[model samples]
Target: MRLMLVEDDDHVAAALTAVLSRHGFAVTHCRSGAEALQAMLPDDRAPFDVVLLDLGLPDTDGFEVCGRIRKVSTTPVIMVTARSDVRSRIHGLNLGADDYVVKPYDTGELLARIHAVARRTTPGTPDPADPVPGSDVLRLGAVTVELTTRQVNVGGAAVPLTRKEFDLLALLAGRPGVVFRREQIISEVWRTSWEGTGRTLEVHVASLRAKLRTPALIETVRGVGYRLVPPAAA
Candidate 1:
């Protein structure tokens, strides 16, 4: 993958670039926010796959740069910085960052995150195993999932759902009795392998049960994962 590293510190950038290059990534080191932005412009070269941004840029704040980049391109941006406060994380996500990694992160985890963001952003053919393929709809007892339309309804009534919530439900509902490992769900849904994603996955599952008004619909296997128990009619 083609990656852009935006950091003002030469040593830090050099270290990261070397690591990324060794992993088969074409790394472009940008010393300032302006330089990063200029490189992102439409050019003869193929566009970058992902960007690793540092908040302590020489010319501009990384958050501002992220916002500006969003206005110009759809390339995924992952904020790699020393800011670890809750507010900073929220603010970076609010500015359209695909992921946030605090300093002192494991290189292996960073590589996984980079691949996740790139895969999520890139357009590709639909999985052949996806349940809702032709008509783009799947029905489980009283619950209904419309994949193409991105809608969900329960017993003829519409149930509002965020994007991730719907995705979680659809994944489980596709194979009612099969248990889905937490890691598999996260990788397929969030497209990331970060250990911290487990909490987010749990929250989404709880929200799905509540919204569907079926607490027993999704059963949690002890020390395993989760599975959808199809209703009687289904």
Candidate 2:
């Protein structure tokens, strides 16, 4: 995966770039907000898979950079900073950060989060529950999920879904009326055993419901997990 590392500190950026490079990620190191923006221009033919942003920068605040990037690209942004306050985390997320990682985080966890976000944002990668060759489409009521093309439509109109959202929907849609455990969804979709991922799952589910405008399409089985309710059943 190609990753943009926006950190003003040379030593820190170098260390992270090396680590991520060893993990098979092509890292583009930027020392300031301006440099990061410049690298993200349309002229820069190489597209980035994810962005690792630091709150401290020489030219402008990281939040401002994040907001600006959101205006131009839907590339997932993960804020890597020392600001551990809840407000800071909330504010970063509000500014379009997909995930916030505090400084002094475990390297393993960081790698996991990187893979997690990339899985949700990269559509080219095949989904685990890849549909059969001839049966690449699943329809649940007004919702239609084209597995091969990674397209979702509702009521004959297209519905945009984040990578994670599509994975979750596809997983459940594969087995309509069967409740998938929360842990199973996290492991399958997020590719993590981290329990904290449960909250992220809930957030994705809520967002999916709002976007699809078919809340009844995904039925939540309290204490268990969720299932797709076919239109006939609904």
Candidate 3:
């Protein structure tokens, strides 16, 4: 796998880079969010399969940086945070992060998460759309999500959603404000393991929030999971 690591800590970056490279992965190290952004652009020279990002960057909040990155790329991102709080994990996931690892984490565990994400996103594995809106357009908040073409619109502006992100949105919007459990969403959105892809739930929710004009509509039910509460009804 090709990995882009955005970390300001020189020792951690170097040690992790060497470890991943030794395991036959291409590693690109960036010291700040700006460097990471430049590497992700079309002219970044190297193609990255995934990103290992540190949340405590000197330049910007990692979550804010992730929100910006999700506007264009679907290359999976795994957040590296110092805190192990659930809210922080949820926030990272909500900001389009694929997975997360707290500081002093085991290298093997990080590699395992990367492999799991990589496996699910294998190239040419056809993405399946939502069963309900597979042929129709969906309206949620200010966004018009086209199922047939996989496009979204908010505030008269075009929005882009990845295949998985769109499917998740369609499922949640099917019953607006109905609190769908984490496992239930996994079954509906992805016909895969609940635990293996639970993090995907957070990623798609984050992506949808960023795309939708009224982000507050996607309500987090605290200990439960996510719910789609349309603004007009809220």
Q: Estimate each model's TM-score.
A: 0.54, 0.55, 0.52
Top candidate on lDDT is 2
Error of 3 at 158 (Å): 60
Model 3 misses residue 113 by how many Å?
Answer: 0.8
Which residue runs does candidate 1 get wrong by more than 4 Å?
125-234
Candidate 2 TM-score, C-alpha based: 0.55
lDDT of 1 at 166: 86
- The residue ranges of model 3 lying beyond 4 angstroms of the native Cα positions read 44-46, 124-234
TM-score order of candidates, best first?
Answer: 2, 1, 3
Q: Which window of ten consecutive residues has the lowest lDDT sum in model 3?
A: 124-133
**Model 1 agreement with the true structure over 184-228: per-residue lDDT tens digits:** 678778988738998998899999989999889998877657888
Per-residue error (Å), model 1, residue 204: 36
Q: What is the C-alpha RMSD of each candidate to the true structure, in Å?
A: 12.0, 13.5, 17.1
Q: Candidate 2: where is the Cα deviation over 4 Å?
A: 126-234
Residues 1-234, candidate 3, lDDT per residue (tens digit)?
578999999998898887676444788899999889988889736567888889899988888878888898988898987979999999999988888889889665576577667657656321222234244766765677676677778877987778778778777665565565576567657876477786778887887787675778788878656777766876
